[model samples]
Target chain A: MMGAPLLEVRNLESFYGPIMAIRGVSLSVEEGQIVTVLGANGAGKSTLLKTISGIMDPEKGSVSFDGAEIQGEEPHRIVSRGIVHVPEGREVFPLLSVDENLSLGAYTRKDRSAIERDREMVFEYFPILAERRHQEAGTLSGGQQQMLAIGRGLMLRPRIMLLDEPSLGLSPLLVQEIFAILGRLNREEGVTMMLVEQNARIALELAHVGYVMEIGRIVMNGDADRLMQSEDIKAFYLGQQEAGQRSEKRWKRKKTWR
Target chain B: MDGVQLLVSGLANGCVYGLIALGFVLIYKATEAVNFAQGDFMMLGAFVTLGLTNAEYLHLPFWIAAPLAILIMAFFGYLLDLLILRHLFGQSQTAVVILTIALGFVIRFVAGVIWGHEPQTLESPLAFGDVSLGGVVLGMADVAVIVVTVLLTWSLYQFFQRTKLGLAMQAASQNQMAAYFMGIPVKRVQGLIWGLSGATAAVAGILFASKGAIDPNAGLLGIKAFAAAVIGGFGSLPGALAGGLIVGVIEPFAARYLAAGYSQIAPYALLLAVLVFRPHGLFSQVRTKKV
Candidate 1:
């Protein structure tokens, strides 16, 4: 949509021990856009984010953030380059208080005044965290932990945030509220995001562009609204197709996409 | 001896064990590796100071030689991590523990080659005869030992609580991967913790050497310190001091109250009892990692 995408990937491959986890995967996120990768379990969505964030190395391919190649840099180096990854499990330090966890999020920054302002802004988004500022992170409820995770990521003032499964294990009401906040952040703060999720309906609703991943490769990509309307997606992912409503004898499944 | 005299002596010895156990906890906290070589590190520090202060050698005064020895040990700790422990990262925890045991042997052998096999006394300026308080008598060396232990422990507590670098070290020790994600230099922090542990071990060695005779086997005392760490809840500093006091007091009282031979096993018996009641140690809480 612009001169260049804010984040770009090409032919990425990664492995876990002896198993091939991600094979020749590629995707991109343009500035100010919310892109979502939707897939079932074992589809390598987390692997893709981990590779881009430099938590794991790719056997082949390049990852360029903004304009620089950062395929094999250390995770800390990647964060300083303005790409923050909120990992799948909401890994806030269990023993550390909420305040200390947020302070640690700004570990890489030297702009003290801006860090303070950002902390205030994070508290604005998650008022519960502010109320429990001195409480240990482990004691917070699941929804609160997810909020703390995002708030910690925000402390970095990242240009692009890679959030993995923000809606996982959350109640529908909580999921709706979290996605609404994410949408507001994108529209108001201009923060680009690449979200990975298995909850297809909510993910598609929040994303501008959606990619369907099966196994380790992208099988489908299009506007999120169009993908949501696709018959195959409606049948398989959205659970909208009932047995009597289908005209065909059996639904066809695509194996590959070019 | 009166009960008061026995208590003071027990506490003085406990302070020495506490100092050594603190070293064990420091290295273990940062790397999650139980360093069997910690006692050897203390022995090396004592040997270095002895070599420097010996009348035949440099003959440096205790004040100068002790600090110099600690500084060198600190450097040695950094190199030990850089040259050996750094490469062991991501390796099996059991393998690293065995390697540390090997490292202990290497240090002991090296010290034997350099300083001979005989035991010798370390001279201290404060070793002036015993000071008697009413009916109880206390050695000036014992008083010196207690004072140094309290001061060192307080300073280390302040360092961890007040400084950014120290907080980073604590954060790294708690969750290394999360700390790295937060942009902390985890590897460098591990190296610094090892250096700090080495410096603390050196202080323990100097204090032990000043109290009595020390030989190459002085490092064997590290095993007892390891027990102290476990009894105190391995990661907690104040627990280490408490564990040491418990162990130190138990041993001497065992000899006086129980059979003369019971003293040697008294500390271990207490360790076993604590383990039976609180397997995580007296001070540690059960931490369950989120899935």
Candidate 2:
């Protein structure tokens, strides 16, 4: 929080047709820190990540990564600048082989030996991908597809990775496994991450700092541990309250934040 | 003997169709837009080569004229993306289709203005005596056609499977959004794809004109290539080649054994039957949209 953040967004506004999807949203992620944006469905969480990654252009404000502004630049150019967006729904190229998908992740780089080494590294991280390297990506299960998507992102050797809904369709066990990998990636490799998720509990558990967005605006922001302990957060996000004692009438008496 | 002769001729014709069909499939795969102007591009190719080789025009030798025409066509295709198609990105697919159809007409009219109304024969190095085997005869031009088709197809196979740039093209074609996220310059790659397709169409045009006379109306041959693409599966490369060969072979066979009228309708009939049985084409990946 003291030094200049690795990624900084200020007064960002994005629209889809006439409707504003994310408005006046501002946040920052320091290098090597894991930051999570938690929100419910239709809260513009995906929009925030998409705007920052240059998948969608912002109408107002700025996004600066490593001290360089990158608003309205092309997605490919943004990636070359060291930011990679793993889009929502894990959009792996269905017709391509797993190996081909991995190779494509390093598309922007020219270092031949490094690319080969990274390909091997990705396979090592996801051994099942190695086994199915020759198989079409579409044939993989939902969990496996998610792994492939993250694996593809890793091949970029990106400085800042923007991940959207990594746990969206994953089973509980698979989600734990993926979150563990994300934690390891942050801890060991020092890769900065901006994770947008609806799974608040696990997301807060993984992140050092957290932001809560509601209807295209950041409603609350604090340290992850402090947010987890907040009474309003407990009543709304976690559904756990001090006095409730797990009663069936908990929904009836819960304070509405909206 | 008559059957063998007809088969050989049919295959030669099919190879020409396959070349044109490759252009159609390449554009369709990369952009998901069926370029109606693809056949018109072929017509332009023939006209350019004619302008270069005809005694009254540039009067260059066939060797120089053919390569020069191919290069011109490639540049023309690249310009098309930069000047026209790039502006239409993110628009409705139907709008793009209609624009391409209109483009086909524009190319045809321009070709007519430049070349004229009369059909012109193209001269190639192989346009000479026929090679007879027992009772069957094979034109040297036809042999050249087969050799060029095999070589072109083989090289394209190597490109898509072996080369990095080719792999980038495949990735762009499969999922443009994901490709962009993966740091591929999708727009530039798309322009390159259009150029590649144009160059391919040029080769097809030259091979086709070598066998007969070509006129501005010859651009209508694109409809046959379109039919070939549909039969092969619109996005599959090998399917395009197979589809073209099937259509090409069927026409001559129907004309001889059946009736000339049957030959005219054979390609459409085959298309209808395939649509009823396998709408996705023979080699297409059947995709299910995820919720």
Candidate 3:
């Protein structure tokens, strides 16, 4: 359902030492769509995000974004090329002030006026950041840091944003708010997203396309709605399909091991 | 000499200590590791000055030789960062200390081998005469030391606060990974910091050597610089200066007012007191770990 792929990974294999984290996995995201990678613990979701963003090199295949090869570029170079990655566990620089953290996101950009405009856009998306601009980031709560991380990523104004575990350690309310924000960014800003989440149900719900990665391999893939309704997805994650239920038993199962 | 005269001398010495302390802090902030080689870097600056000012090589005017020496030291600073310091990165802090300790021995041996172990002094514009105010004579070198240290520190403070590169350095010091993500050449900024530290150490070395005969073994003062850093708060530039001044002011006063043996213990006592009370340092932000 597309005009060639906006981002494509064909026969990609990423490794960590001798242990293979992503084995011959291929996926694609179109120009303006949300694609979520849903999986359980020990899955290759984080590696997939990192490898695409050029933080970790894939041992065996190509990562082509917008039909351009970006397999061997450095992470900063990848970011400068407009592929921003918000790493796992919200790796916001804790010692820096909120404003410093935001300013650093536009580190590679030299257009002062445009950078200032983007800064305002990010502040609008997360007003708490403006209020706590001078405050050191480490002191903020988990939810606020997650918001800051996203805000920092938004500072790049990237066409395709790769977010890794944006909801980890967040409260239920905060998680919902985060998902809502992601949905809005996709719908309103037309920013394509590659979201990796352990929360399989919500990830699939917000996504147009979903892939299930199990033990370093792409085990299942299809339309998000269909995957959400699949027996295997329900069996492992949803437990029982309640039409209005978002708080499923699978979260309790994932929390212990995540 | 009266109390005021003794106080003036102590203040000058304190300023030297503070400058060296700043050098220590500069390297530590960039690397998050101690460079025991810092004192040797300072000694090398003085030796370079001697070479330039010697009636042989660049035997140019004082104005030219002093700056040429500092620049040469800065170049070597960059070289050292490229060759030695860069290789030790990502290693444990303890390993960094050991590496630099080894570097210090090499620097001292090489400097002694190449330049000889003879004690020397760089030429100075100031004479032995002192400025007498209300019958207390303050040596010209003492006044020069204090005035120069204050002016240099103030200018450096302005530079760090105003310049974009300086801001980048501060960002890298706080969190290198975040800075790299921002498109900053974090490693290059680190090399620049090391170069700046080398330049600062040269200034401190030149000023300190003015008060005495310079020898290659003089780098042993790095221990004192380390104490100053610990006392001031490891990463705080202001703290390094204040710590240096505290140590400088303590030594002579203790020798004169208290027991001479107690002078050696004074700075350590202050450092211990500060460590036990505010470990993050007087000016440093308390780092919070995610764990």
Per-candidate DockQ versus the true complex?
Answer: 0.59, 0.70, 0.46
Q: What is the interface root-mean-square deviation of candidate 1?
A: 1.5
Ranking by lDDT: 2, 1, 3
In candidate 2, which residue ranges exceed 4 Å CA deviation?
A241-258, B289-291
Summarize candidate 2's per-residue lDDT along A1-258 as a digit string, tens digits: 468999999999999778898989999999999999999998999888888888889999999998999999998899999899998898999888999999999998899899889888777778899999999998888888899999999999999999999998888999999999999888878889999999999999999999999999999999999999987788778878567556545556644455
Model 3 agreement with the true structure over B1-291: per-residue lDDT tens digits? 577787889888888778888888888888888888888888988888877776754577777877888888888888889887788777789988898899889989998987789887767554246888878888888888898899999889878766667777888888776666666777888999888988888887778777777888989988887888888889889988888888888888888888877878988888889889988777775666553
Ranking by DockQ: 2, 1, 3
DockQ of 3: 0.46
Question: Please, what is the TM-score per model?
Answer: 0.95, 0.96, 0.90
How does chain A of candidate 3 score by TM-score against the true chain A? 0.91
The TM-score obtained by model 2 is 0.96
- Give lDDT: candidate 1, residue B258: 92
Query: Model 1, stretches more than 4 Å misplaced?
Result: A242-258, B132-135
Error of 2 at B68 (Å): 1.5
Candidate 3 structure quality by residue, lDDT tens digits, A1-258: 467888999888988778898889899999899999988777888888878877689998899987789996887788888888887777777876898788778777789899899889888778888999999889888888888889888888887889888888888888999899889888888889999988887888899999988888787889999988876677676666444456455444342222
The local distance difference test score of model 3 is: 0.83
Query: How would you encode candidate 2's per-residue C-alpha lDDT over B48-102 as one tens digit per residue?
Result: 9989998888899989999999999999999999999999998987888899899
| Alpha-carbon runs more than 4 Å astray in model 3 | A239-258, B126-129, B133-136
Per-residue lDDT over A95-125 for candidate 1, one digit per residue giving the tens place of the 0 to 100 score: 7789888888888898989999999998888
